[model samples]
Target: MNRVVVVGASAGGLSAAEALRRAGHEGTITLVGDEPQTPYDRPPLSKQLLGGDWEPDRLALRSGPDLDALALELRLGVPATALDPAARSVTLADGVRLEYDALVVATGVRARRLPGTDGVAGVHTLRTLQDALALRARLRAGRRLVVVGGGFLGTEVAAVARGLGVEVTLVEPAPVPLAPAIGEQAGRFLTRLHQENGVRVRVETAVGEVLSAEGAVTGVRLTDASVLPADEVLVAIGCVPNTEWLADSGLTVRDGLFCDEYCGAAPGVYGVGDVARWYNPLFGTDMRVEHRTNASEQAMAVARTLVGPGERRPFAPVPYFWSDQYGTRFQAYGHLRGHDEARVLDSDFAGRRLLVAYRTGDRIAGVLAAGVAPRPLRALRALVAARTPWEAALADPNAG
Candidate 1:
């Protein structure tokens, strides 16, 4: 392709752009994003970014010198209003048009906003650096923080807020924080952890409305007619794909832009990051992973596919993700779906290290653990590539 356009990128688009430039693609490459800032590591937004490290070097995905070297055309802070696959161009919100021979849609997902809380001030969602910056300023001692969801973002924000000595209350409709991802057995582990940390975690709680006065939030009203006081309420319930613009682009969008095994959306179009729902043969599921790793992996693969046929491998990488909370670093490798069993080979919640192995009917499917044990992620790609059996992984001391 002589000209390539990439849109809606957070984690993967940056890598895909670099990989394209690195692979000697001597063509006009345009990277477009709605967010003003360059792509940085989002996993840090809730962690270190909240801790107040907003330096350019730390948050910048591509440095000025690199951008100068590549001279890649960038249309930052401009959102694509419409995409036309037939016309081979995109219409920007500013009414400008961008034409390309190939298009990589990397628009990542956005945090879903609560309906009743639209007018509620001090209520926020953490997705971009600006969100983290604003939230960080609000996290001070004596501030009553009502976290509206017990998902990863909410839990992480709660952890950080509590560390800053803020009063944190977490509300979740589910019984535990991560019941949707991990089973009840593992979710209880977090419930106890939150409680032990002096965080008030409310389960089976439904928010009917958010109370506000003077154009600012004050508290939340539960469906049970109880009103909880809060200085700020953060909604981390869920995320929606940034694919609403592609509704007319003719690409299949189911929750996210659905793609084939190679992250290919259409003939000359593809998607990466949180926006792409690619089929995973290993899990036998169509996964739309919002993790940082998926963005980078799928983007690199897509970039290669656009470049040449150097290697034709299905876009299947061992799914891995990590989160740090309450001083413990949680990591996971492989798809933890339909796991017949999960055995705790080792655990020291107090020591901040634990190992949990997931098996799919006698075959090891995934592993979640704490600490810097990288073996699971290192060999996981090969294992998934080869469809390796779990007997050998279970026999290995590090994995089991």
Candidate 2:
């Protein structure tokens, strides 16, 4: 427990590193990241920072001096290429090998690119600070922005584009945006919301190829042979877990690196955040949460497991995520997937109300509301933790 190493520059990786040091490891701590710059906050990159309303420094969760003050050996700009479980060592991209007593894999994920869109200029994805910078510069007024995929990122970017006075068209292959997680009813309502706010939404519209003119994006040609003109295109299709570097490694990796409840992958190696898949006894499944809360909780768990455990907290933190669209703050608690029914606890969907979600044959599963007070959300977290029955929670005791 003297020395610990964490890999990844994403939220989970950074959180894990900071948690280990703050918990008084009193030993050598190293943070290795693949991305060149120091670890920066990502969620804001899609909202405030990319929207040109916030400075780049505002996107940083912690600064360089902060890492030094915490006494961490931050190996920034280096990515781990391989893992040796038997020898307890990691191979960096620069052919340097480092050994550690314990390791935490928080390598997060990378955005999936369009097959033929790479050579096309003006096509972009917003997963990193660099990507945001490039896209922000292109957010000029009168520009026609076509956002591929109607997921959270695409929708959020559309909102920003519209706000910047750019003509935006969102192309989604799904029947509706967020229909997979939030249900079709909710997704339909959201679609209307977007259209009302000046975003042109196209459902079940697949982009066959990103049209290019002189090596730069001109528009997108849909599967139906219709061509939609655009000056810039944002691809927010999805993300891939950064577990490829461990292909030859001993640890098992499916969608993400598999780990136990303690965030430990092997005896000493741990995994967290978007690159981790851990069993949640509460949910009776292997949960791989991709939220800032997961990063903080998993890092704390990994830190406790590495250092001597005095008193520890469980890894059963209720997952939480938030999104900003059209100047409204949206928040969610608990897992949204695997839910059978959604109950309107105390929400006026027309005017930003709290919506409580429940799982089939069980208790509350998730929550969604517009601008709810922080206090009630905490109570809902308690209810979700206690596995509170939905029927009683439906009465809306202190609606959030």
Q: Identify the candidate with maximal TM-score.
A: 2
lDDT, candidates in the order shown? 0.81, 0.81
Give the per-residue lDDT of model 2 (tens digit) for 1-400: 7777888877777777777777777877788998877778888888888888898888777876786787778787888999998898999999998898888888998899999877688999888899999999999899999999998889999998899999999998888898887766657756777898999988887999888889999899999788999999999998899998899887889899998766668978888888899887666678887777778778877777666566544577678888788867778887787688876555555675545565646688777766667878777777777777877665556645
Residues 1-400 of candidate 1 have per-residue lDDT tens digits of 8999988646788888888988779999888989877667788888888866454359777778877777678889999989999889999889999999998998888898988666667988998888888888888999999998888788888988988999999999987678657556566777777789989988898788988999899899988788889998888988999888888888899999999988888878888888899987776668888898888888888888889766856787778887788888778777775677777766666766667767676566777777636765455445544556777766664453
Candidate 2: residue 272 lDDT (0-100): 84
Candidate 2, superposed: residue stretches over 4 Å from native: 310-314, 347-350, 374-376
Q: If candidate 2 were superposed on the true structure by all CA atoms, what would the RMSD be?
A: 1.8
Clashes of 2: 0
